[model samples]
Target: MHLPKNAHVALVDGENFVVMRNGGAPLEPKLDRSEKPDLSASNYSAGVKHQDDAGQALGRTDLEELAHGAAAAAWLNAKAVAGEIDDILVIADPKTLGEMRRHYHTELEKRLVGEIAKTLTGEPTKRIEQIIADA
Candidate 1:
């Protein structure tokens, strides 16, 4: 849980994604909001359907949620491929995290430092830093 200085921390959910950078010591991370990139156009599940083993409709697919996850993954892939990130910690909701995992790029995998399966997108920066430190 020791976030190196200048490491990137990404907090994401189905609808929200926030990136922050550690601006303090590794043991006492001071996360500062970096940027909020617009990712509303990466929907890859527009016409996808979900079905059970019996071929019955499982439920309606959450298109917005799917889009957000896909968008976040694409963004991370781009950053990784471009060598824009040295280290990154991903903190996301369980479902979104799974979606992202399905689309992670090899480059992104290499830059990933850690992952926490929790929804911290709406949490304040201080709270996130504390949670990561405690973890």
Candidate 2:
């Protein structure tokens, strides 16, 4: 798995992202965003919640999680189209990675070099590089 000389990598999670270029030091993302879940959503409301005999909610959804994935995908799309990045490596947790895959534009999809299903947003750059190298 040889990395392209100037390939870009993004370490992403539900709430944050850190972008880096392969041949250079890691840098702060040009576009960084964090979103709070909508408190008005039914899930957060004080209603008699439905539950099975086991007292489990039928399902769960998070707006903040969705927002983070969308923002990251949008940023990647913009950078790829602007020629700021040619190749891309994405490191994210399984769910966020799935969301990113769902939201990626065709152009950005073509630029994807690799996807690592692991959360690395809080990792230092040196550790990230080593992980990429090891992978």
Candidate 3:
């Protein structure tokens, strides 16, 4: 099925978000997953690092990560709302569902799918189709 053009895409990445947030580039205006803020090439499930929570692996998370992730998600939300995207797909931990929801209640949904979002919540992720269907 084709998604609506200018869909709200809520892309999430705990690690990169935190890095960029702390690293200082929120106003640089680039893709959220730009390689400039990569902490390192994490051998994650997909090698797609943006979805990973920057500090979830160490049992301790920083406000920077949380804020960064939320910021990224919010950016997507704003962009989507402005008709810049077609849909919003949160790529962080489902455990952060409540946090994500609280942070970005405007988003249609937040789901845990990748290693970082998974690691944060330590829970299995639901299917994207299923999530969209539910939404």
Most TM-score-accurate candidate: 1
lDDT of each: 0.84, 0.67, 0.37
Best-fitting candidate, measured by lDDT?
1
Report the poorest 10 consecutive residues by lDDT, candidate 2.
38-47
- 1-135 per-residue lDDT for model 2 (tens digits): 456766777777777777766664333222222222222122222112322434334334454665577678878888788877788888998877877787788889889988999988777666777777767
Candidate 1 lDDT: 0.84
**Model 1 TM-score relative to the real fold:** 0.87
Clashes of each: 0, 0, 13
Q: Tell how far residue 67 is off in model 2, in angstroms.
A: 1.5
Could you tell me how far off, in angstroms, the CA of residue 45 lies in candidate 2 after the best superposition? 20
lDDT at position 96, candidate 3: 41
RMSD of each: 2.9, 7.5, 13.4
